[model samples]
Target: MTYTFTCKKVPLSDSVKEYAQKRIDKLGRYFQDDPAVHVSFSVEREVLCAVEITIRSGSTILRSQSQAVDGDMRGAIDSGVAYIERQILKNKTRLAKRLRSEGFPSVVEDVSFAVKEEAEFDIVRTKHVPVKPMTAEEAILQMNLIGHGFFIFRNASDNAVSIVYRRNNGGYGLILADDME
Candidate 1:
């Protein structure tokens, strides 16, 4: 796998770079094709060292970030890689399903990880609601009136489906679905 490293507010040493590359290269065993991996190192509050790793393969993206309490970049890198591995393990079955159903290129190798029995997720409730065409502002108002965190509606301007939700930062976020083509 190819690795691109970036440093922010911290001086990257040759040894640190080599260490990170070697550690991240171990993940290549899980993929059938080499994925592009980007790692960013940064120092926060002049004490905490942070590392963020992003792996991109075809249309799938895997990302994880970790901070070192002891200000060790290597530790942060290790933690980030471990987090990514856990994410891969947790979503292995879902990814395989997507590969079969959507025809997406498989980044993972079938032989690398053991396939374990996955817990079933049951859908207990189903609700059918009319998707009303409305502006984004009107959707937000409706969401607030209904005391719900999010409201899904058809955008009046484009007649496309959209979702408006209240953000944790006391703001609003809108998700508009567009054609990939």
Candidate 2:
């Protein structure tokens, strides 16, 4: 597996690089031949340390990030890696389903999909769903009932359509699409 560590707004240190590489090495078992891991470290306001980890195997990509305000870069990196692993574990079922449904060939098959004609974007594959008029609260409820991260609907008040999605911080986010223009 190949590991790429990038540092931003922080001085590169051998200890820091070695520590990140060591942590990344633990993820090698998840892929064949030590999947390449991309690790990025950055400092913000000279107080907050951030670490991002990205692992890619074929078309499957898993990523996670973490931040620490106490200036603990190692802790931030470890936390980010752990969060990524947790995400992988949590989405294992969905990942397996996507692999099966999306024809994500077996790990043994190293064939590239770039040359395949079917790999191109297909308009017909786009799902056209109708947006019903409802309040943001209603959309949130519906999204929760359907176990979906997002729900699109027309606002009952203004008759404009919008989207409501779940946020990473256990909150809901809204995307308003104004047709007033």
> Cα-based RMSD of the predictions, in order?
6.1, 11.7
TM-score, prediction 2: 0.53
Q: TM-score of each candidate?
A: 0.61, 0.53
Residues 41-68, model 1: lDDT tens digits: 9998899999999998766778988999
lDDT of 1: 0.82
Q: What clash pairs does model 2 have?
A: none
Model 2, 37: alpha-carbon shift in Å?
1.4
Off by over 4 Å in 1: 97-118, 121-181
